[model samples]
Target: MYSLNKIIESTGELVSAKVFGKEQNRIFQDNFNSIWEKQRDSKLNIAVIGEFSSGKSTLINTLIHRNLLKTGFMVTTAAPAYLFNGREDYLYICAALADRKGYFIKIWEDGGKTVVEAYKETGPGLYKTLSKDGRSWIEYNEHLQFPEKLEDILAYMTTVEDAVKKMEKIEIFLPRNSLPEKMVIIDTPGVNPGKKDSSEHEMRTRKILEDIADTVLILFPADSVYTQTFEDFLNKNAARFMKHAVLMITMMDRVQEGEREEITEFAREKIKNKFHLKDPFLLSCSAGRAGKDEYWRSKFQKAEEQLMDNLRKKRERILAERTAGLLDNLLQEMNKTVDLKMEEITQKESRLREASVPNLRRTLDESYKEREWKIRAVKKQFKKSLSDDKEAMKVQAVAKVREELAKRKKRLDITKYVQNEKGLNAAVTESSQGMIGRAEYYCDLAGKKTLELKKELDEILIKYYGTIGAEAENEVQGRHAGSDVSVINSLIGNAITDVQKQENKNANSRDKWAAGIGIGVGLIVGGPLLAVGGLFLGIVGGDSLFVESSRTKVLNSFSAALPEIADKIEALLIENVNSAVTEQSNRLAAYKDQLEKRYQSVYDQIVGNIESQKAAVMKEKSEKEEIKEEIRRLKMNLEQWKRSR
Candidate 1:
């Protein structure tokens, strides 16, 4: 079997051959590089996510056999905490200084030597600081020591309100035996923060799960099992999470002994039926009693073993599968390009044998012009349809936002906002931030709709001028028989077989790709919501005096501002939707242009080859033969690689 390194190297060679367009090759190279880096690092990131008080922290504490994370009835985790295995027990406090930047304050000790260093952020996860002379770099600080004050510092940085606000994340390093080597456990803030409107917390957690996590541990308290909020979260991210997630029923000790089996069985049924997971990996344990209770200890051991097994086995499988899928797609597309080029050459040769140079040139020009007109018409209709979609989407989005705000209004604590102007601003800010998830949903919807429209346009073009190998094969076979038809048919057969194999190997991979696209759309659309909070702050800041007069006055002021707030949200949603739609339209146009250029290049090459047939017939034929040979070689290599695994 070919290793991932060998596969990646082969892919790089093919990409360098210019099988794809410039932009496409660049994208493939970036993805391949990322895969290579991840494979080289060989680290598994397991993110634990849940609702407030869902035993997420307790589970990590149990695994590490340390009471490091703070736990309470309220929302305790303020930022994501990364736990890693190390030689010494220490931690780094990452304080957020600005967007995508932070200061890392490291505290550690070895023997009698203590190290406390502060590094200013210079790049993403990269840091540097000024030297004592203020000209060079050095790593040292005199603020604190390790072990003695580590717990205090961690608690303050991770849980305390004021300290938490300044913190980006907490990185805890423990003894080598504390965790599996090359494994990092990330504890994220609860997605459902009970009564607290902490949209930032949810967004941060969602980002981690979607982008960073290799495997996810979703915790559900045994006492409560699956709540509607949890179900909703799963529904939204089901494609990304279900394949990589392990459902854990934590705090099992809280449930009655007689009902434990029943509850576990019930949860399993829900996973299989509601979530459509046929055989989900699940564990029930009481992290709080794992150290002291024998039965709970056994359960915890099982959970730990399961995690270790996934770390050892699942990571390599996922990487291999992804790499194979990528290579297969690249090779198939390359083969298709070769087939199209061959078909063009054959068509031009036939025309050259029958017509004079001037007549052949005229015929090619007319064909090009007719196809170009069809493409233009398709693009025009596509743009108009997207514009219509933007308007309709805006109306629906506004209605949804209004309904959500109305629900929040009934539950609003008027007295809380009436306390001060800051409180009122915070309330408005939270309300606006709360719409981010909804905005992302709308963006994802628009993205899918745009893709569907683009697909329709592509189909229309395929109907008018068939560039796809199968369609071209039928046309060519109708005109010429024997060897040419055989070659084209074989190429199409192999391409079809490869696609079928990919589909059979895993349908989930395509779902993952779609989910990734949704994440990109969400980031673009959700960004405006962050500023929506500040936008509303300006509108409601003037009403602070009226808000402070009485709870009734505060409610009245907020109610009056609702229409304006709704209008603002509608405008932002429309703007965001428009931006997303325009981006997709531009991409479609680029794709169409790329196709046109590829075919045009082939036509020009055919024209030149025919014009110089007396002088260059043998040379052009030899070059065409080499292309066919290369296509055959690539197809064989891809098939062999797939079978070897």
Candidate 2:
């Protein structure tokens, strides 16, 4: 009802995903496949093994309620034989073809899937008809054989060639509802027999013991306590291969009735402790001598029931243990990854803490102040130089203007053009346009001078910060000794280098107009020229407009506005320089803070991911340990129960 088979299958899949390494994963996957194949509507293979002349065949014959196998006067069951319950009689034999190897053609419902040419007649060569359920039958012939009676089966198995057994294995199917549904009783060739093919028999027996025996039945004779050879065989195999084995002490009738209990106790104790057999069977197959008896029949039946019960319990135990074993390996593999990652994270955190410089905020403040002082000092020196240049430019502009005006006033013959008010107005407008052009040219020169001075200041700031950035890198490497702060160093270092190489095409570059310095004196003085024609028209119409007064108005505009325009231009240059200088200082000041924030963010992300993964692994490991412990306790309880019984 528990469907443990399903659980076991699913667990294998789960372990496959969790286990690491290609080979390791593949091994577990194969183990799961094997477990499923052996458990899924599959037969329990009970291999009957004993010395020659031991009552193994007789015991089996009596148990199945038919003389289904040869008992006396045979060459010790020359080949291995498998007995199963079938609706009709069937037999299969695999014979040695060449080089100590054997091959048999398997004829199944699927129409001869395998054909081995090692034998003379291969493939479905003997079968005449397949049943409605696809069960087939074959005839006795050269390469294929099907014997109907048990005597014929015995005669076929005893056939030999070149001192080696011709037959490899035999399958005898009997119609018996009393046989366990999913069970196959394999009657193997007796070990340590004095026969020519004894080595082959031993080899086959050992292979079955190692590979496929779910339950091994070790038969001994009650007439003799234990032969040295049989004891040695049990020593080598019982504890190693027979986790679900039973020690059957046959020939009990040969011993005296009074000493039966002593012999039984002696054999049971010897087997239970030495061979790890919890229960050693004591029964006699001597009833086969006078034909099978009801008493021996009942005894073998009872023993068969006990063996089936043990098989059931053994399967449950083995499944639980196998499941636990795989889960244990999976847990171990996962723990390796978990522990390694956790160690890396812990070491990183430790390194970070050890390398962390205390009073980081104070350190940042000090570094900021150092760069701030350099910035302010450069600005002060550059500011003074800029002011001096502006004053000199203003003096040159004033001197050039005054000299030009003196020469223009002296050259102008105002009397000639005075009679024609239009000519006089035109002359005055032309002279005003010339003066405005000179003022704009001077303002343009002043703008260039301001850029050159600012460029020089910026270069100084760039050099200072470059030095600061280099020093910061050295400090970071020294202080955070083991911790990786490469990202932080790169960001700050790159910021400084970028500002140094940043193209300042707007600074002192020709064809690059300074948008900050507006039209200067041109917009103000040029506006009066557009109105000069209106003034000329008014005067020519004799509308009380004096030509000389108009001349005075135009000349006064240039002379009076020159000083005011110079001051405004100087103020605009000062404002622009201050802005550039302040921005540079602020950027340098924030770099330290930005680097700290970035480092903290990366550190937090790494720690968070590591902790999350570690927690999950730890939780899973804890749960697996609990399951393992419970299974351990269950096995312990089972052993205690067996001992008590």
Candidate 3:
């Protein structure tokens, strides 16, 4: 039987033995090092996501057996909280600054005293603190000597609008002896909070699920299981994460004893029928009464045991499978490299025996011309495809903006904005912000489309030119043609970066639009109404008519602006898509020249070295046979190791 570490060690030894060329060896080493690090320190990240007032915080508190997290009806958990097992309690709070930096404050108990420290993120994962005058940052790690308690730090993680606006996230360390060692629980913000910023919250939580989470727990309050909002959320986003999801019904005590089983079955059937999640992992727990009530404690214990059991059984198997897959890929790549080298040697030997230098040069030149013509055709097709996609995306962007705005208009409470100028301002701000959010959503979609285009273009290029050392025609290629292929890949990568850059720039412009439109609408509607004796009407007890007139004017103005706002968003999307397409087209226009240069270089080398190559063909033929044998042995070993798992 072969162990994982042993397999990794063997692969590393082979990669380090100079079996591959210099560039191949470097790439393999980097890949191996990354997988090695993952194998060394892999942890399961379980993200808990739900709507507001869904008992997420209470469930986490129950899991950790601590009443540390604040739980109530006011959206207590404003920022994501990462809970980890530790020997003692510690809290780290990160606040976002106006300059797009982070201010981190770490609080923990040391020597029976509460220690507090502050730092700022100067780079990714690099923290530093300011000097005495706050003019420069320095690498100082001493405690700030502030007598701050755990409760004081927890306030920063609350839903106070000011605090929530500035907060990035919070990290909590708990002394949970029963928790699995490699398990981290992330309590994310409600995906559908009852606030104006629900879209932002949903996007944030969705990002966590897509990028960081290994498993997910979607919580529903037992008494109100599967509400319309819950169903809507699952419909829009559940398929992406359902493979690793657990449907948890919290606050089970709120339901009657006899109805709990029926409710559970009903909820399970609903999810199964709608989301196609066969036999989803569903659990019921009363987190609010976790420790105080015996019945609830027993229920909580069963749920906890089931969750931990699943994690324990799945984590090691997942890691092993991933490691095996990476190792297999590495071996396959190495085999390809060796095979290409052997093929090059064999082709050179045959050409030396059969053809004169002049004949070979003429054959190579003809092949180069044919390949260049085909490449030009592919480039032309790629540009046309990109242009068509850009136009289609523009139309799609306009429709999406209109759809989002229409939904906002339908959901607006006209009466709420009729009271005063402040109310009207809130309405305008909400509408504009929603517009910005929808534009951002479209930008994200466009970014993904750009990547898909790049991938398709890459596949087309590789199909025509072949991969790495394997060119379409054998007569005009070199062993290091992979370097030129990599240049093409780099150009595609730059196109992706350009799309993201444009997306960010448009986001900033949308922010400006949101601010300016909100203020402009407020003044446009509120000024004339007040100036035309509406205030006097209120003083004379005719306020109802004045309020109605104000509401009508505000609604009319907003309705008129909707098309203008949507048009602005559509223009931004078109600009971003065009920029991405143009950048890729410009980069790809150089592909023909690059390939030509590579072909010329290889042609010159072959023509100049024909006599030397003919002299060494016999010796190189024997070496190629030895290399083939070595590759066969490595492939056999890789298969055996894979089977050993």
Query: For all the candidates, what are their Cα RMSDs to the real structure?
Result: 40.9, 20.6, 37.8
Candidate 1 whole-model C-alpha lDDT, 0 to 1: 0.58
lDDT of 1 by residue, 1-645 (tens): 555567566656655665467887777677677667778888888888888899998888888877778776864776788888876544333334222355455655446444445567687766685332211112123222223455555666666555556555677877766777688899988877745546767887888866677777889899999888788887885445575477889888998899999999998898778878878888888889889989889888988898677666656655665565566666566566556656766776776445332443344344444443432343344344444444443344344434433443321233332333443333443444434334444445444544544444445335433442111111111111111223323332343334334333333343344445545554566665544543344334323422233334334444544445444544554455445545544544554455455545655665686567534544545654564465456556655755665
State the lDDT of candidate 3 residue by residue for 1-645, as single tens digits: 556567566656755665556887787777666556656777787888888889998888888776667778875566677777766544333334333357665666567655555567788778786433221221233211222456555654455555555445666766645368878898877877766878877887777765567667889898788888777876776565574477889988998999999999999999888788868888889988978999889989999888778766555454455455555655576556655655676776576445333443444445444433432343244334444444443344334433433333211233332223343233333333433343333434333433433344334324433341222221212112122223323332343334334434543454454445445554566875543453343333333223344334444444444444334433443454344434433333344345445545555566557556544654555654565455455556656755654
Provide the overall lDDT of each model, using Cα atoms, as 2-decimal numbers. Answer: 0.58, 0.52, 0.56
lDDT minimum window of 10 residues, candidate 1? 472-481
Q: What is the lDDT of residue 84 in candidate 1?
A: 82
lDDT of 2 by residue, 88-196 (tens): 4433333332322334323211232322222333345642222221112223223335344335544455434322344545565656554677778888777777757
TM-score-superior candidate, 2 or 3: 2
**Candidate 1 wrongly placed segments (more than 4 Å):** 12-18, 21-26, 89-102, 108-149, 160-162, 194-198, 325-645
User: lDDT: which is higher, 1 or 2?
Assistant: 1
Give every collision pair in model 1: none
Q: What TM-score does candidate 1 reach?
A: 0.48
Worst 10 residues of 2 by lDDT: 473-482
